[model samples]
Target: MNPALANRPGQHLRIAALLCTLLLSLLGAGARAELQLLDGIAAIVNDDVVMLSELRAETEMIYQQLLRTQNQAPPRDALAGQVLERLILDKLQLAIAQRAGAQISESELDQAVAQVAEGQGLSVEQLFAQAAADGLSRDWVRDKIRNEVIIGRVQQSIVNRRITISDQEIDNFLNTNSSELLNAEELQIGHLMLPLSSGTDEQTIAATREKAEALREQILQGADFRQLAVLHSSGQNALQGGDLGWRAANQLPTAFAIALRDLEPGQVTAPIRTDA
Candidate 1:
């Protein structure tokens, strides 16, 4: 058995699960705009309404987060599609939790936040500071963490429990990836990005540059980075305030390394350019 799986609470969080089976079916071309409803219906998952706003926010969040961490522009259509699908699956799981009379509690949410902090190798204070840089409030992060946990529990109750992974599969994974996996150290990071795109027209180029400069000013002025990112960033994790949680340096791109070298804790960069 996977050690992590063995170590989990007797009850797992199923509601937070992102089911592989459902991810492809729910999303469409990854447009930056929210998903529109056809005659006032976005999409039906079992019995739920996924508003365009929710879909858009989640997609933008994923996009911004990906760009900041990966340091590469994702194919918008593909990523958006996948994100939308994940949100729908999440909605489905959330609904199931509701049906089962499951409700999240404040203590549970707090525990989730603590779990996230511990995983990141941060003290609660450090986690809050990082979260702030990403423009996320402690409450929001806690709620998000809680949602994921609940979803995971719900998924396990319904689906994961039903599926069985063979020992051979585990053995194969260990054989192929054990050395690097065992040696890896995880780091949780909160990232925010302001993307400056080159313009076709000189005026447009100037305007984009102005926007980037303004974004930097906002950060300097104590404006919330994640909120601004959510509102203005062209990257994916805008909704989550450009948070790219714990990851190894190898998973990040070269440009990110350069950017990180100059950034002090709690400082935001002026502007960075990338080819889309």
Candidate 2:
């Protein structure tokens, strides 16, 4: 409001424009800072990039899911790495599927979404609202489901191409193991490894076996497996509560499959020693 400038409407307008521009510049700087904090390239997967924001969102989703199931989430740093690896794998598989001309129809996507909603005991709209409350957008959830469907299709295609079962083999399998095969269910496995170094003495090996046995006893006595895993496991996923997630019976090692075969849910296997 300089007296001389106040007499000229054009000068006043120019000054007002200048103030507005300055305010916008300040605001833009803040916005840029926030964007930098919230989003960036987390990893490079061939021609694709995994964003930090995506990793965080997935990590949060898994953490919340674990909590809902009454299981403790792993440490953030560990969980983030696990989520990032999964994202990278998904990206790679999606790329492969794309090259193989794998496509998900709109109906397929919708069906998959519906199934997810049903699994969560929510309507589609309610699922969207819950996702939003959890800081995920509807588009993200849809895209995630679509990608999963694509991956599944591609994997099935690959397996079908690789495995050939003759009529004789099928008949033999049915005759010998039909009941087991028919009754087999997918298993969600957890692992905790107490590693032993190479060339370790018998005394050290015996000590490690004793420790493993003690841990197994504690688990059988109702101690939380995941808590103990986080505290004592030296495995790669130690921080992830030693969770191995779900696996098919065929996907597990022969010994593991055998050991888990007769076990009921929540039952722990006897400690099995292995060379590190």
Candidate 3:
């Protein structure tokens, strides 16, 4: 199964959940009064709820981090939606881990926390102090790490059960250009296709080509590629900012691989005609 497509159901659920929250937020003041006092439910996953406060905290943390790192951050609502979706997925995975009897002992949790501190070149107490300065409590950091460990364990177990490697396939892989394949570069491609029907007239075709060229020019001149894609793309992942996700060059179509061959990071390619 294609892992990318496998998450469609979850994606749908996330979109529905985000829209529901958005709708509630837009209701009259009287309707929102109770929600403001009691806090709101961002999403309901199985028996667990993702509270609005939790989502807001995560979203704000990420937003602040992005401000410190990237030149620009995604729109606030978009960032919140992404954060809520991730929380929902994490909650589902945690539930699965619980059912599968996956447990992380206190000692293991302490070790994990220590490792995190070591990675940051700080001692445990210093790490806690820094987290406090960053407005994150020690318990929050520990819980986040614990959940991550559980999720990782559950994902590995699921993959092990679902994957089978035939001896012949392994032998073939080892005998081939294995080193090159292992080191192959993966690219995150964003695409926006201006689709055309089989019987499209030359005039219409010309117009579409012109439009595509204009969009490419816009991207070259510092326009946000993903935003433009979301606004105009006719591709399957249009709603996802036309993201094709990370793909190995060898796994992509010959045309795409060739088109991307000489491009550097952040460089846009010239318009290429394709039969879509």
Candidate 4:
């Protein structure tokens, strides 16, 4: 406490009066702004409307993030449009997920936050401190994390339903090209996969890419790939150290086949994006 405040007998009264004044000022400002944001719609998505408040919040968040990470921001108008469009997509998907009864509980959001913290080698407190430094409130971060989770659920639910194929479809495909499929050369491949899920931010994608490149360099330097994969890979065979044995040329996906086509038996390629 200040020495003057400590010495003064009515210091408590002074502090309380100052707080009351500040609260009143804040309330007055909020009351003025609240009406416009509460009533104004930014975009309409079917039965739901995106409020001006939401657009402003998302734009502010992304604008701050870009300023911090890039040391500069694009023109505000362009950035606001981009951010608003993203918010609209999120609102649409989240509405669908809600209709499908998908929700992220508080515990789940907490766990996701913790996992993100762990991935960055930080504790929860440190993570929040960094987020504060980035001008992100804890609540805002939690909401973003929740949106990501729910969107993943919605996309998975919709895409799986849309793309499901019957056994007869598989049989027909096989029968259509039997000779070429039967005679195609097969490669015995062992590898890792790192999935970059939908709606991930550029910063995260860049960090992940750097990690993958570093691991690639280590593998080239004779570091044990299997152990490294087991430790860091998110691939389905991560527990088996990324061993996907004896895949046929016809069966190998285009990206992998192209990346690995020229490699020798013991060689590993750089990070490949199957989705891309």
The TM-score leader among the candidates is: 2
> Over 4 Å off in model 1, which ranges?
1-42, 121-139, 159-276
Model 3: weakest 10-residue lDDT segment is: 63-72
lDDT of 4 by residue, 1-276 (tens): 789778897979988999999999999999989765555789998888888777777667656655553455555565566566666777889888888889887899899989877966889889888778767789877888888888988888877888778999798896777788789888887777666999989999899899999999999998877656555666644434567878898778788888878888888888886673
Point out the higher-scoring one by TM-score: 2 or 4.
2
Residues 152-266, candidate 1, lDDT per residue (tens digit)? 7886787666768799968977677667866655555555554445547777767878887887898899876665555555444444656777777545555665666656678
What would you estimate as the lDDT of candidate 4? 0.77
Residue 32 in candidate 3 has what lDDT? 67
lDDT of candidate 2 at residue 91, scale 0 to 100 = 93
TM-score of each: 0.40, 0.64, 0.56, 0.46
Can you tell me which runs of candidate 4 are displaced by over 4 Å?
1-39, 68-72, 119-121, 165-276
The sequence of per-residue lDDT tens digits that candidate 2 reaches over residues 1-276 is: 588877787987888999999999999999999877867899999999999898989888767766665467667776676677778888999999989999988998999999999988999999899889889999999998999889888878887998888999788776877667666688998898887888989999899999999999999888889867766787645546788888879667677888999999999898876543
User: Which stretches of candidate 2 lie above 4 Å from their native place?
Assistant: 1-38, 166-168, 174-256, 270-276
lDDT winner, 1 or 4: 4
Best by lDDT: 2
Give the higher-lDDT candidate: 2 or 3: 2
Q: Against the unseen true structure, what C-alpha lDDT does each candidate score?
A: 0.65, 0.83, 0.81, 0.77
Better of 3 and 4 by lDDT: 3
Clashing pairs in 2: none
Which 10 successive residues of model 2 have the least lDDT summed? 65-74
The superposed Cα distance between candidate 2 and the true structure at residue 122, in angstroms, equals 1.6
